[model samples]
Target: MSAVASETKTRQLPYVVAITEGVREVLKEQANAFVAGEDVAGAGSVYGYYRGLLDEFGADRIYDTPISEKGIIGLGVGAAAAGLRPVLDIMFMDFIGECMDEIANQMAKMRFMFGGSATLPITVLTMAGAGANLAAQHSQSLEAWLAHLPGLKVVMPATPYDAKGLIIAAARDDNPVFVVLNKMSLAMMGDVPEGPYEVPIGKANVVRTGKNYTIVTLGRMLGQALDAAKQLAELGIDAEVIDARSVQPFDTEAVIKSVEKTHRAMVVHEAVRFGGFGAEIAAQIQEHAFDYLDAPVARVGAPFSPVPFSPALEKVYVPNAERIVVVAREQLGI
Candidate 1:
């Protein structure tokens, strides 16, 4: 094993660094594991998450590829089918359009298509969200697009802890998992365990507990919901924040249980409010917990338009904590 792979640090690191640590750990234990992405080794990735991985694991394990999402995803799909675990670092989630066949058809359906005789453990690490002002082409929270596909496990980690655990779990799973790391949360830091661990896929995390209402959100919106919860507390309103980390194998039970207790629920996300994935959660909560609700489940998300390029417009484009607070108030009839 390389020196970087051998040494494990216990100190707190940013979300990106924690992800790097997870990659390093995965490569060490799984000798068949390799990371391939555009500019990953040459430029330390488009986001600097793999800065020191190339030097530690050498060019063979951690390397760059053509500026092609199709090629990178193809490599992962092919390598995974041949008994090698490969993680494709798609620079931006928006680029998923370039390799829909490889992802939605090939990687996603490999094991099932092979009659369960194969283990296609391919992890596609991609960035999602619109806070960086990279224009519409570069900035988009496309988790909803991938979640709609079958045979794919989708995870959106909002904290450093979930980032590392989910990626590690995705790497080790015998199925294709998309690790949708939000760009806005890359710098957000939290206490991450030193040893190898997993937050477990298909689970919901209740970051804050309250009895009045339940806030179901994931990725960057999770932080916004938590912040809104504190402000709602001042108004004698208790809000429970549920981080729907695994969007595909969604933990509907946890959400239903929360709503059953609170009798109210709100769904929030950074994606476009219209036709966004939040609509799915809202529908499910209402369908399963309808009898326990006091009012219709509210949703908070971006406006129904392309993400703006200008900083001022982008600021208004993404959902914020204040909007969640306002929606919560409206639901309470306050």
Candidate 2:
């Protein structure tokens, strides 16, 4: 077998391994591709996703920045605008608030504001959601805030397959992309193709099909939803699971179609219930599939409170398989 075929035949790796592979592929493919963020270079990212990148790419390409979110993003935006592809690492998704102006106003709007004269090919890779007992600040899922922005592309890949492919696609795109990785998913092991792959932005993947109800989810919440679907099946309620991989350019058509078929919908996420991505999904479902609905749209998410530091409280605060099953049954009138 050829070298390519040999690599392709290798067994599947974990989500964090796929991420590392994706970054290595991008740096190998693009001369201008570089990485910058806190503890990214020498320390190899907070989660060690960039472990060997510094050694392979050298200090210039794999740079270490100060503990300043604004500075890190601003530098990435500047580099992207100047014709280089820069991938930035914000230690946690919650810190996005510190660089909201840089992201929302600057990087997101630069291309459109410049009348298409400039392309900001920047990717902001950050970890989100509450499962690690990291407390409120480090565990919040704020993809809703980024998705609300018009000019930015928001991507949340649930599986190792999509994670590797989507990260490469985001890096290669000429527009700004926010690639949010769930901290809990980093060590997840799954099958991933070895060659460079690209999962298109704004596309939704139907993970499982059923005719009874539709469960729309993203990020780590997807696993919970799938598990819940199995339990719902035993209870005589068939549930379809749709992974809303990209939120900004959301796949409303898929969601509408799924809801129309099932006539019952439940949106799930790791974010808070109020102002979460579930709200958007619920609103969209009501708007498009209202006539076909057999029951009201239900939402499964974290409570409207800060993530607790204790593992016991943290487990209760975050939605899990049990919560998903309960919400699905409630929506299905089971």
Candidate 3:
């Protein structure tokens, strides 16, 4: 990402297009790679993310399957073991519960169980986040649940650029990775490279920098935290914002360095506060950067409950700039 190339950028595409383009690029390069899921073929995908993949790859490479989560995971796990890269499409990550055994045991452990002889280059593409009023089942950010499991690489991309780059990276890895795309940021337009690229996994991006405080978050929550950081500047408070893009292989070193500089840290997410993924991050920050803290680490998230169907209730349930501001103020005793 050079200045001349970044400034010379010609195309800005919607978030979904980046994904479609990445998959298209990979399918063109890798003969053994194919996409499989219900309604993914044709233009029947829930988010229209795979709208044109079928036309490019043909019916053989882009094929549909029964509406079964177990079948989808099984297909990907078996295909990967047999030396093919299968991007299994799980419409909503919330549906992971439908095939937990297949995911938790088969796909996540096949390589390890086979003494490193088997490679499950399986990338599970799914949508998450609490907006669109799709209710609890259709809309939820379940990264924590997947990240808790060993032998799985969980990736959540916040921007269109990362969406494309990380997709390419995840597809190339031998580990089973969960590519969790947030629906809330689907329509966001941003500068994207024309060809495929890789954003290294297990790294965090410092989206904004300041000396007074640090805000670590990802997905839709990163936008809200940035908004809060901007407002915090009005009152003469400088805040650094970090996007922990890949949660499982989290960039703890980056976060610790930020905390060491700012002396205060806040973790935010759209998921519920209790036992949420932020807790894991907060604990890590405390462990590695405890002496640098001027105040206890603060976490801002929705209340512990199912995602509300009502848009009004849902708005309050998810973390917002106002809540973030209040929580940051409380953390600093301002």
Number of clashes in every candidate structure?
0, 0, 0
**Model 2 residue 279 lDDT?**
95
User: How much RMSD separates candidate 2 from the native structure?
Assistant: 2.5
- Tell how far residue 54 is off in model 2, in angstroms: 1.2
Model 1 TM-score on a 0 to 1 scale: 0.95
Per-residue C-alpha lDDT of model 2 across residues 1-334, encoded as one tens digit per residue? 0123454654578999898888888999999999999999999988999999999989889999999999999999898878899989998999999999999999888888899898889988899978887998999989999999988999998988888888998999888898999989988888887878788888898999998889999788899988998999999888899999999899999999998899988999888899998899999999988899988899998899988899989988999899988777666667
Which lDDT tens digits does candidate 3 get at residues 122-185?
8888999887899989888888888888899998889888888788888988889888999988
Best by TM-score: 3
Comparing 1 and 2 by TM-score, which wins? 2
Instruction: List the pairs of residues colliding in candidate 3.
Output: none
Off by over 4 Å in 1: 1-10
Error of 1 at 95 (Å): 0.3
RMSD in order of candidates: 3.4, 2.5, 1.6
- The stretch of ten residues in a row with the least summed lDDT in candidate 2 is 1-10
Model 1 worst lDDT run, 10 consecutive residues: 1-10
